[model samples]
Target: MNLKSSVGLLFFLFTALAKAQTDTTRIKSYADQVMVRMNLDTNIDQFIFTEGPEDKQLETILMTNNKTRLSFSVDYRIISATLSITPRFLPGNNDNELKGTSSYTDFRFRFFPKKFIQTVYYKNIQGFYLENMKDLFPDWKEGKDPYFQFPNLRVQSYGGSTAYVMKKDFSLKSIYTQGEWQKESRGSWVPIMDYDLSIFRNLIDGQKSKETQYSFGGSMGYFYNWVLGSKKRVNIAPNISLGAGGMFSSSWDILDDGSKANRENTEYFIFKFSAGLHIGYNTDRFLFGGKFNVNANVYNETENQSVQNNNIFGLLYIGYRFPPPKVVERNYDKVQKKIPIL
Candidate 1:
């Protein structure tokens, strides 16, 4: 080839290379700006880039300039080259199941309507679920106890509950519990269920009540259901929690002679008070949780230890947490430098 022609070709090639480098730098600069605008300056876990006609967008660098999409979608995946952009948004939530680990701050509101999956005590476990089971009574109408007739008693129970998140963690939640015991004298076998369904609200702001808190010498909030922790391993993923609260309660004594104890006329005052302390380990399917709850009442009128009544209830339960999942962690590492693309 002629020397002149060769020189011209080389010049053309150099010009094209320089132009490409400039374009690449501009695109990268734009992506960095987009990240700054979105307040997501940190290194991303993984970003999916998209634009269309899909192929029309070049993979110039790690930086992408789709700032317009920062607010509308997650990341994009360009499947074509027509510039027909598909703004992919964050994960979709069907029912209450959310994708991936929600931010710590968002953990509270993200897992709402925490489904109630009660794992009844061993005695209450008639089958797979309480929902479907033959009426143990088969004919309780003719008898007294709904599940049975004569006098069957239920003793020993276990279970505790909490809000189950997508990553298999628990949060502020209402507990659950059941207790009953009976002895059959003659008639039939029956199940006894005695428990209170109540919400106790207390506040300790100068010994007063407020919207979300309560105070006194000490403060108390509304809660029921006590499930203590277990010293054993029962499932693949292990979860444990400790809960406590104080509130007013009553004492009831049931006599086999079909006679009730001296019932006290209730007044609008703190008649009795109690505390609940629980520790539990729950699995996605069965939560073998246990708890120890104590209720004591020192007669207000007279401070007499003998006159006061103190009772403790310990139970174990096997239930399920909603959106049951294996616990996971989303670790965030600060990005000081960009990783080179291989």
Candidate 2:
């Protein structure tokens, strides 16, 4: 099926199963409160390509210049949304001179209903530079030589994941969004299915090429929340997951006459691995936390060639929870009555 059809199907399935359920003895829900948060994070989008014989192997690393991102988020009832942007003024994001100018923007929305968590997101990234310039050119100097850059390369992805928690007491929301607080320590096995459609564009020597990729995968993950402190306000959680999937890719070259040529199609198997740790301090009104995560996707391009997309990032956030304003509550109630699922 196409991207839109696939996404719509997922939405319908999740909505059919939507219900408000939680174990109050082990988890505390903030569905009645409006939570606002600010987050600072670092995002890395790097692609590594390897080719050639074992003795004379070569590798190329392409990476975006903007590494730091700022985000604002709001959570109320069953919905949570966040918007993130890479600002050049942030520390470690101002190396455009050496790495090339890049831009990144992301928007994410999530829903929590019973034991199911559904998420949808969109990402836009542009510009990339060769990060291993020294390895490629032995005599290249960091400050003296400019790295090779791809100014006309852009990538956009529309993606979503559907997940279910197997244990009723485990609070995945506490670890993911701090929308809830787990009063007791607990763990759960979560099964997740993910799907995405991505578009890549590049221009070289007055020629433009575009590629579209459709991917889907399933994974099993284990998450644990270790609540500590006298007031159960501290939590330390770690999680890991492994999965395998496949991608269908189609590419075409745009000719000067505005027609397409050199059409190609390929299919590949993909392996995915991810791990993360979260530490947070939570209170009735305030919450603060930090998380570190790493994700890698590896796929073979040819008999002797491979590609890896590796992303490693860290995030810190602070949030406050408060009662919703009267107008906001009234409007949300009216909408919830009509939708029922909310």
Candidate 3:
């Protein structure tokens, strides 16, 4: 080839390389901006890509103008093209499967904007019980005990809870070993927290006393996906948490005339420890799961009267898993950034 022609070709190649590098840097800046807008600027565990076959390589990138969100994959796939909303409907027997009906609904929304997903939940329960009241107060006597005798003993509670789960997905490489075709399993460790407030009513004989409780806590756990059959998988997660809260009970007195009088409020500090096991089956579109939770609460009113409460419950839930939107990768070189930088 002539020297002039060779020089021209080299110039063209250099220009292309520079442009590609510039695009990589530009997309990264845009991603950081989206994180800041979503108030997740410091969260390193947030995932911005979708999981797929390793050979079917794709690069996902997020771009935002602070007001508008745009995302695309390297192969021009629409990684975050369309948004999806899934509403979870759950109804089941009481926590202990002892009696009563328990139900709750959750609404989930996802967006390409910081890959945001939000869940809002509300629950109403009646006649739900923890355990026999006699178990907590073992030294009960008809007239000698500080409390009066009742025909039946049980608890009724109703409350609402809200939680934020950081959006995340397993990448293909992390799901498999190097050069191995072992069925790639998906797993994610995300930050999850919830707040709950409830009113608990205790029935003694035929009379009623009420208490209000407030609790907030966070837990870290891994959701491991296992293939159960063709095109089907099961998700299992185990978690532990610790929390602090308080409870306020309204004091009431029963007169000799069989009348009831409301007294002042009695307050107690509550410390909570909980462990949960969750198992679920999932198709490409829907997921169904059963969760068993056990928690213990230590209540201290003073140095004299301290009590321990145990709660056990089972919940069944069903929801839809929306398809991830098309992804656009601007900088394919940095696609494998470590996630959940725990």
- In the range 274-321, model 3's lDDT, one tens digit per residue, is 554455664434445565555556665555445555444445544433
- TM-score, candidate 3, is 0.40
TM for every model, in the order presented, reads 0.21, 0.91, 0.40
Candidate 2, residue 179: how far the Cα is off, in Å: 0.5
Can you write out model 2's per-residue Cα lDDT over 1-342, one digit (the tens) per residue?
532353354334333322222234477989899999999998889999999877888999999988889999999988999999987778988777877899999999999988999999999999999999999999999888889999899999999999999997888999989989998777778999999999999999989999999999988887767777999899877777789999999999999888999999999999987777789999889999998777778999898899998887789999999999999999999999899888
Best by TM-score: 2
Q: What ranking of all candidate models by TM-score puts the best one first? A: 2, 3, 1
The parts of candidate 1 lying over 4 Å away from their true place are 1-170, 174-219, 222-272, 301-306, 320-342
Q: Rate the local accuracy (lDDT) of all candidates.
A: 0.23, 0.87, 0.35
Across residues 1-342, which tens digit of lDDT does each residue of candidate 1 receive? 432353344344333332322111000011111110011111111111223343453211111111111111111011001011213342321111212111110000111232223222111200111111133324434222322111111112222222222211222222322111011101111111122222222222222211111111111222222222363222111112222333233323334564545433322222344334344443323344444444433323222111222343444444322321222111111121242110
lDDT of 2 at 204: 95
Mark the 10 consecutive residues where model 2 has the least summed lDDT.
Answer: 13-22
